[model samples]
Target: MTKDTIIQFHNVRFCYDEVCAINNVNFNILENSLTAIIGPNGGGKSTIFKILSGLLKPDDGHFSLRKGSTIGYVSQFTDFDLSFPITVLEMVLSGTICKKVKPFYRYKKSHRDKARNAIKRVGLEMYEDRGINQLSGGELKRAVIARALASDANIIVLDEPDSSLDVEAAADLYRILINLKSDKTILIASHHLDEVIDIADSVLYVKSTVTKFSSTEEVKEKLGGGIII
Candidate 1:
């Protein structure tokens, strides 16, 4: 079966203070598939993400998402203060802030149900009441993912989600992502491809530009040497 194109970038170019971050970038992302964005440091992966997340506008060319689509973005480094007094459930509930009507100081019953369901989906049902700081690294990452889910996003974009996780935890994280791939379009940016290459349906190699490869083997062969994310 052929999947619909959920996102498209045609000769897209983005810059920051006269410094070109990504140029002549073009790619099509299929719906309900997992795409891994892999590249070296300072290679414009972050810039591409910013553009997709509506944080930055392209200086030239065109970028488009399917109409009525919503994006849920998880940054490489979360700015949330873990030390703050916030429970996992509360954090997930915050994801629905954008959906609240006027006088948004209070949340409706539907919002709480969504948050609780999201936590369960991520396998954090038991930790819903735990303080963010008290959870392990893997557990905390799951909480963040739950927050994205609670927002009712069909497209989920994650940046270095496996960062700082141990080998076992990283493997587990990929398992969770693979499970979610059936219902959501998943995009992940990582400096290392070893973790995601096997699970990703396609690979986007970005280095001041973008190219789509069907598999890791194709990317490695094109480079003509060892695999380098």
Candidate 2:
């Protein structure tokens, strides 16, 4: 891989049982650039996200991350048991727990400080100590993003961040993502074509196959008579 390349997928293929999740995909995510993976439903968008985040491995092909690269991931919101008490601060700090760190080890002061800063960055300072259940939908999404930022990863990947968010909330999240692109390579799996086209430095269009475009117009051209939205 080139020095500018932070993540590379060479002829990658992935499958789950009988379903083909990804098919012979190849792409390079440039350092410090914002890339958006956009496609229709069942277009293998989430599968690609999983592959890049290391949550799932490809069934075939080669995938590589640059040496010493760190990755942070923000997943979609799911049904959480509000009764399982956990503070927002604690949830964000959990990102700092490295693989080498023992589960029994307590988080240090530095970890707490980082979590606080992350929460502040996402404009959630007042909600730091609140229970996870207490946050509204937008607030919960911001808190999850704080956790990702707290990870301090070189590459940050988010899955459907705008899901279930109102228009204002989604716009706020997009602004945060645009700001973060300067410091970290940002990749998102989104169905929000307009938002993605506006901020993305490159576009990854996933279908039965995967294709990468350097510009929105290029992506539209390749869509071959299909509307971008």
Candidate 3:
């Protein structure tokens, strides 16, 4: 692999019990670039994130990352209760739960410091002590980003971050993403074309596979079909 490539998919293919998910998908993710994954429902967009995040293994092909690379997945914790009695700081700290631990195992003061710094980095310093249940949708997403930052991961993958937010909230999220683009390799699954067109350097339109991988400005012109989101 070249020094610029961070993740490579070699003839990647995936199948469900009987249906195909990804088909001969080949792509390369470079360092410090934002690649937006876009497609309709059940178009294997989530499957791509699952495979990249190690939540599921592809049936036929494989992916490889740069040595010592770490993926900070933000959307995998969706099953947890949003109303749970946890502060934003506590939730962010959980991102590195297994990173440093002793036999007794309580979150260290150092961990809290990292979480605090990450919260501030994401513009969530004011919400550090706020309850998760009381946060707005936009605020919660920023907190999740803080969690990813605290994980000390160079690659951050978020699945459908724009799913539930309003236009204003989505715009807020987009601003944070733009701020992070200078340093992190972000792979987010989103359908909002308005947001992705502005934020993504490259766009991966995956309809069961990679239909096109091109500059954001050329995607609409080259895709040969209408983009729903």
Candidate 4:
């Protein structure tokens, strides 16, 4: 119950049919810090994100967000149907719904302004008015990030944001994350341990369970000589 603790998982467990996706997971996420959850694919990373984002309910145990806390999540998926017409700005503006404004009401200027700021933060200001179909893979990833940012949530979750980007695009993504760490509390599930270790204040290495949770230095030492989930 520390003042800065924003999230906690108490003996959290999830089962898919008969297979255990997560077992006895327990951890606390502090406010205003970046946490990297690193593990192999199919190791339940997406399952955990789904649970946190309220897309799924764990079969057992509990995960709690501090009172009044709100979260914005962008998944690792980018399999968008490009032909589905939607502009980048419009997509980002969708995040404004989190504000709980009246339904069917036209978005105010403030909403558009905030969405634009988020677009600029992701370096997509020039493409704001363009159809999402026009964006490259990397650009699409950043656009999703902008959508999350526009939500104005105190906590943000990003799952494998660097999955298919080229080295330069991935580097740019990291830069935006670095700038964001100063304000928003961020949780990321990434396999790029070497790249994220430097920026992450803490790390959670999971393999159907939490294998390690500690400062970056300590976790690196614990994982020395090899990287495996």
Candidate 5:
């Protein structure tokens, strides 16, 4: 069966001030597929994701998502302010605030249910009421993922989800991501390609341009090493 295309980038280009991040980039992401974007440190992987997450506009060309599609972003936990006294449930609940239409928006019972379910999905149910600062590295990562899932987004974009994780924790994260792909279209940008290569349905190698690979072999052949620097 042919899957529906979730996102399409047609000769997209973006520049930060005078520096071009991505130029003439093109790719399409299919529904219910997990795609890993890998590249060098200064490559345009971050640009591609920023565009996808609606955090930035393309300076040129076309970047489109399926009509009415929403994106949920899971940034690295390190990007969060851990010192803040916020519970896991509260963190996840904030994800739903973006969809609020009223000037004085309030979360409904259904929203809380979704947040609870999202926490369960990431296996963080036990820590739902725990303060975010109290969680370990792996648990914090899962909490952030749960926050994204709580938004009921059709596409999930994660930036270096395994950045600070140990080997076992990284493996655990991959498992959670694989399970997520059964329902959500997932995009992850990681320098640790080997960790995600086996689980990803496809790979997007981004430099100033983008190329899609269907298999790990092709990615290995193109990237030169199984792990991207």
Candidate 6:
């Protein structure tokens, strides 16, 4: 791998229950670059994200990261039990805790401080003490992002970050993400065409049987009239 390459996937193939999710995918994500992955629903975008985050292993082929690379991931929103008692601060702190010790260990003060700064960076300072269940949809998303930031990772991956966010909220989130681009490589799987184009240094278009990687303008040209926002 070149010094610039932070992630490399060579002839990677992944399947789920005998169905192909990704096929012979070969790509590289450069260090400190912002890459956006876009595709139609059921196009295996999330599956690819899972692989990069180490949540799932590829069925065949090789995937490697630069030595000592650290990754942080924020998943798409899903239904959760509102009754589960956890504060936003506690949730963000959990990311730091997970990195330091096994799941059974208690959180440390340094973890709490890192979480607090992450919350502040996302402009959710006042909501730190609020119960996660009490947050608005946008606020909840911000909390999750804060948690990812607290991971102190060399790479950050986010799945469907714009879902359920209003225009202003989405813009705010994008600003925060842009600010983060200088510190680490960022890979986001999103269908928000306008947002992706605004921030992306590269774009990865995933299909059931093929994956294409290119710059935003190149992808737009390759897709022709299909590049609608």
Q: How many clashes in each candidate?
A: 0, 0, 1, 0, 0, 0
Which digits, one per residue and each the tens of the lDDT, describe model 4 over residues 1-229?
A: 5899998988999998999989999889999888888887778788888899899898899999989888889886755677978999999998886446667878789999999999999999999999988998889989999999999988889999988788899899888888888888888888778787778888887789986556777877778524644
Q: Which 10 residues in a row give candidate 5 its minimum summed lDDT?
A: 220-229
lDDT of 2 by residue, 1-229 (tens): 9989999999888888998978999999999999988888888888888887888988899899999988888887664566668899999998877778676788899999999998988888998889998988788888888898898888988888887888899888898888888888999887777777778999988895887899988876776433553
- Any runs in candidate 1 off by more than 4 Å, and if so which? 1-3, 99-101, 224-228
Q: Which stretches of candidate 3 lie over 4 Å from their true place?
A: 76-78, 99-102, 224-226
Clashing pairs in 3: 193-229
- Give me the runs in candidate 4 sitting further than 4 Å from their true place: 98-103, 225-229
Task: Give residue 38's lDDT in candidate 2 (0 to 100).
Answer: 85
Give the Å shift of residue 60 in candidate 2. Answer: 0.8
Provide the TM-score for each candidate, comma-separated.
0.93, 0.93, 0.93, 0.93, 0.94, 0.92
How well is each residue in 79-148 modelled by candidate 6, as lDDT tens digits?
4555789999988987786555566688788888999999998899999999998998778888898988
| Local distance difference test, candidate 5 | 0.87
Per-residue lDDT of candidate 3, residues 10-70 (tens digit): 7888888899988999889999989888878888888888888888898887899999898
Per-candidate alpha-carbon RMSD to the true structure: 2.1, 2.0, 1.9, 1.9, 1.9, 2.1
Error of 3 at 131 (Å): 1.2
lDDT of 5 by residue, 203-224 (tens): 9988899889988888888776
Model 5 scores a TM of: 0.94
Question: How does residue 15 of candidate 6 score in lDDT?
Answer: 90
Question: Candidate 1 versus the native: TM-score?
Answer: 0.93
Which of the predicted structures, 4 or 6, would earn the higher TM-score when compared with the native? Answer: 4
| Candidate 5 stretches greater than 4 Å from native | 1-3, 98-101
Count clashing residue pairs in model 6. 0
